[model samples]
Target: MSLTDDAHLPPGLALAWGAPAKSNRLGRKPTQSVEQIVDAALELADADGFAALSMPKLAQKIGLTANAIYRYVRSRDELLVLIGDAAWGAPPDRVADAPDWRAAAAIWTQAMVDRCDVHPWLCDLPIRGAPMTPNLLGWAEAILKVLTGAGLSPSEGLACALLLDGYARRIASARRDVRDSATTSVQPAAVTRFLEPRLQELGYSILASMMAGNEYSDEIHDADVTFGLDRILDGIDVLITQKRSSV
Candidate 1:
């Protein structure tokens, strides 16, 4: 949806796009810009976690009153949207240089993984719906461009985009969880030893063999990500083929 007026846009989208706030009571001009607020919010979220980044904490980080941020955003969810957009940044330029739609999609998805690596806190934000912020919409455009170029309709491309987005978030989230557990949980070797016996007794011969051979561990590998994305791309390719033939 095209939104030119700040009043029509959500608080977060407005803040992210630098839309002027709706006319309000005259008061002392705030010393901070929206960029400053988002920058400080990003730093705070990185130092702590997204959950710890309350408005009060953000205000303190920027040396403003607890209620000062209210002038910019109406609620915490709005601020979170702003933060998520900033974290996502811009889609990688390599996507445009990719040789094919499949390559473009792969680059786009890998960029997501790289961003998650930089800001592991990104996967923590609640999905409020489709992309609305400027940078995020840019990414949406990038992915959709490739998908449509491959012959899929806009609706089909969007569905495929959601598929890619879901995979990226799930892989990033699981990778983060595994890395966290590996730090505090029993050693992988110890866990493998404990589960191997149970696997054998449960009549799971294949799993038991893999465990005994140490084919599995707590390590989060990009191979699984590549595997999952390949399957998704294969499915999308099938759809593109079907749609192209019909056209």
Candidate 2:
């Protein structure tokens, strides 16, 4: 649903959009604001990952009883929504002097990647829906302006935005997974050695080749992310060209 659909918004969504503050009667007086609760939740998530952000744990972190935490947020889910909004903060500044939309779009996408790098836990948060939060919508608006200004239709521009966003999330998730796996006992070299013989026996020549070339190494580096992003942008350029040619 649209963020403006205030009449029937979920409690978490309403709070996120700054709906009238709800009265809290459970405690003597709340020492923490909703922003403070969200801030503490973000800090907890950053330090210990998203899995560690239960109500009891977070309440302990902020020196509140588990029930006292409910004074600010109705439930852990609402707190998660608030934490995500806080983590996103604000959109990156627009590139005013950029000569083309592609450059501007690249800047936008890179800003998202950098944000993910800072809060890698963001990659762990499941995307329940579209950009309802303010910062997220701001990011979307920035990119849409670039794409539509480049002569794409609104629908086309939105599609490209989704494409770029998916690419960034996938790359970030892959990198996070690789980093997490590195902490375990299994090593990439050992896995490659074990799989090579089986892959060759199964006649998966391409898989064997990649294994031999170290392409299956469990590391997602900056160059790999850049290559994928450039390819996506290149595809969008082709679409823009086709649209222009037909006009």
Give the candidate number with the greatest TM-score.
1
**Pairs of residues clashing in candidate 2:** none
**For candidate 1, what is the TM-score?**
0.92
Q: What is the per-residue lDDT of model 1 for residues 26-83, given as tens digits with 9 covering 90 to 100?
A: 3868678777888898998988879999999889888888877776667888888988
lDDT at residue 232 of model 2 (Cα atoms): 92
lDDT of 2 by residue, 1-247 (tens): 4435654665478778776445676737788888878888888899988888899988898899888888888887787887887787787776445679988888778778778878888887878887887778888888888999888998999999999988887787777776766766777788888999999999999999999898866677778878888899999999999989999
Relative to the true structure, how large is the alpha-carbon lDDT of every model? Answer: 0.85, 0.82
What TM-score goes with each of the models? Answer: 0.92, 0.85
- For model 2, what is the alpha-carbon lDDT of residue 22? 59
**Which sections of candidate 2 miss by over 4 Å?**
1-7, 94-97, 183-216
User: 77 in model 2: Cα distance from truth in Å?
Assistant: 1.7
Q: Tell me how candidate 1 scores on lDDT.
A: 0.85
lDDT of 2: 0.82
